[model samples]
Target chain A: MNLYVKQTRSISFVPKSILAVLILSFFIQCFWHFTFTNFVAKRHALPEPPKASFIRLASLDDSVSAAKLLMLWLQAFDNQPGVSIPLKELNYDRVIQWMNLILEVDNKIQYPLLAAIRFYAEVQDEEKQRKMIAYVSNKFIEKPNERWATMAHAVYMAKHRVKDVALALDIAKLIRQYAKGDNVPYWAKQMEIFILEDMGELESAKIIIGGLLESGELQDAHQRKFLGQRLEEIEQRQKKGE
Target chain B: MNHNLLLTIAKYSIWEAIRDKFLIFILLGFITLFCISLFIGELAITEGLQMQSAILGSTLRLFSVFTMGLFVITSMVREFNDKGFELILSHPVPRSSYYFGKFCGFSVAALIISFMSFCCLCFYAPVNMSLLWSFSLFCELLIIIALSLLCLFSFNSITISFSVVTAFYILSRSIEAIQLISDSPIVASGSFSYKFINSMLDVIAYIIPDIYKFTQTDWLVYLPDVKTDILIVVSQTLIYVSLISCVALFDLYRKEL
Candidate 1:
């Protein structure tokens, strides 16, 4: 080869060889990466959820994005390498803490509540379900009108997921006690009466349904009529029970 | 490829950057981002200053990369179009020498940005963590500078070169997330497409530098369990930057300019 060609070939050969070695190191790091590289190892490791205050700080006041990002990471956490941990298998304290943090970060979004209902509460373990329900129940106390729906989900978890009417009634009663304002949908307040009927407490259902009919908060004629019908149905059930 | 010639080229390039008001722009940008972070910092429920510094640090890191990338690409392309390369090549200098000289000049610029980030962040985090974060940022910038050089030499279009470099940076930063998701149960297994995709992702992951390991914002909030070692940081930077610079030098040699 001419001198120019020879020089060019030499330069190219060095770079190509360097690239080969660099690539080889990367590949070696992939299979047995912990031997040298923390990148691959860190990728498989689940991060401990940070404190809510710090998360809020890290978000730079963009609570909406912060909440969504946390929710995504939390939901995706159960799927680890080679083996997926069931949602029920997760650390309930951390999961609950994450939900609390996320909710605190952005109260305007229902993302955490949705996770509580759809993902966290849907677990097969009754104890886990109760924990999630209790979390939702307590969180609802802060903003009843906005959070009654999550409590309703908690009520569902109690009634269906945990198969405990008492716990369901407890959560359902919270909707009645705290969700008193008209701005909160009456349907939320009505959950308690429905749960009472489900529990075969016809007298209790009758009293609540009757009280609601007389409370004058039912501005909508349709709601009044629905409660009126519910009262009659409870009375009919009560007579049959006697 | 006289050592003095390479050093001279590097010196003049950095002087030219100062003349272009590049340092002033970076300083002003840093101040502005810090101020914005300050206002947003108060909005945090806790650790207002810590949040401010972390935001500022990460933003400065990104800003440095962008400005450096633009500076290198635009400057090189302008020189190439102006036949400045011919003027320099006529001085008994090899193409590899000129290419590496420019890389050195850009490396200095990267160092400035990383140091600024460290100085601004030291108040919020432990000095060692800030140092690691800043050093990681510097290494990350070095990779970008080298990659930008290769891209500019390869594509020769400002738009195309910047785009490819940008895409590479983004992929490197987020590639870990992609690999992690694939490793998780998110992707359905027992299918050819899944396995094939995973195999491809694995290879790509291995080929690229692990950028997600660098300049992490979490380092500001909580002390990481596995502290990123400075040894790995330096090694990865050296390997990737050297290999990329070599490739750029090789490419430069083939160009007629």
Candidate 2:
């Protein structure tokens, strides 16, 4: 009777030991998660630079000499080397600084601003990339020439770098609105379909491809063939799911 | 005396290899990888040309080595492991005829797979219609398969088949590096281990065919001025493949079945 009692006590002890270990592991995991979330939150909450004070050179009266000086100063501030140097030797921060100056002076110089957006995206700086993209979009709304460049840059940034599906779709819609005659608009639509397919919105992608095929706009043999193949692939995928 | 029967057996061997399930699986896997590559290609917005070339080049290398290695090893090993050779020998088929037939069969299958892969890439990716470079890449894949089969049947062991083929691939890639390292005076004057390593590398380079010679995809995709001499690369590939296949057949015939 006494030995049986002792065996029961040992068996109960095993469960207690396991429970203690589980509790210890749970606490450790929670601690790490708390620390990581706090670190990321604190970093994201930091103040951004004043966007309005940067130079605004939207007019012809802004002297050519003054623009040139501002460009030089921005290069120095951003630490970018002169254009003559090979790209490998160029400083990224200097490129961003010059881009900021261009954005400040003439919001119409979309390429430099796009370069700044690209630099931020490359570094995986999501906050800065987002800020730059938003600023460009606002400028694009006011100016007409920057439309194509803005849409293209946003498509690249959202789809590849940031991987923001909603933003990519919005940019695609914006391209269609702004770019009417050019091939860029069609390419943007294709990119949207691709993004939709990637995101598992098969029905939406099929509808888009079907509409393109039926619209008569894809008159070229090559483009038609490509669309046909893509639609067939999507249909096959859907059938398999069924 | 029975030449017709020998030819029949050889024909059957070729058919069996073409219908191999493992080879089909490898081809399907390669297709999936190619599709994935298009997604990865999007990341090359900054350095478009260089990145595209790298992605395509690496994709070709990966599929060629992996598919060729798997097909060659599995085909050779199964003949021994499954005792399929006994069935062939039970008939009136000459051993040499069987070996040659198997080699030819594998060669055809490898060619078809390589061509299909090239076509798929051409259709899917932004490929230029440069016949010479495309043909050269196909020939290169054939040569790689031929070398792998030669090494595989020579060893007659699946484990050795994989090891030797992988070794050949690495050696082929290292040829230029080996040459550079061998000519370095500092290395020549270094410790025993360093000298020994360099000497070993030199020996490997001499023994292995430089497979990198066949890689012309980058020039085709990137540089407009670069054009491959189609006839030269094709002839070189054929000569190398014939030599390796002949050696492999001789080895197979001499083995005690």
TM-score of chain B of 1: 0.93
Q: lDDT of each model, Cα atoms only?
A: 0.76, 0.59
In model 2, state the lDDT of residue B65: 62
Looking at model 2 chain B, which ten-residue stretch has the lowest summed lDDT?
B44-53
Where model 2 places Cα greater than 4 Å from the true spot, the runs are A1-242, B1-14, B47-50, B90-92, B124-134, B181-196, B224-232
- Distance from true location, Cα of B161 in model 2, Å: 1.2
Q: Itemize residue pairs with steric clashes in candidate 2.
A: A55-A104, A57-A105, A78-A94, A79-A94, A80-A94
Chain A TM-score of each candidate structure, as shown: 0.77, 0.55
| Candidate 2 chain A worst ten-residue window by lDDT | A56-65
Docking class of 1: incorrect
Q: Provide the lowest-lDDT 10-residue window in model 1 chain B.
A: B42-51
Tally clashes: model 1.
Answer: 0
Question: Cα miss at A97, model 2 (Å)?
Answer: 20
Model 1 per-residue lDDT tens digits across residues A57-161: 444333444565566667778865546787766788878777777777656556577677667888888788877787777778888887787787788778886
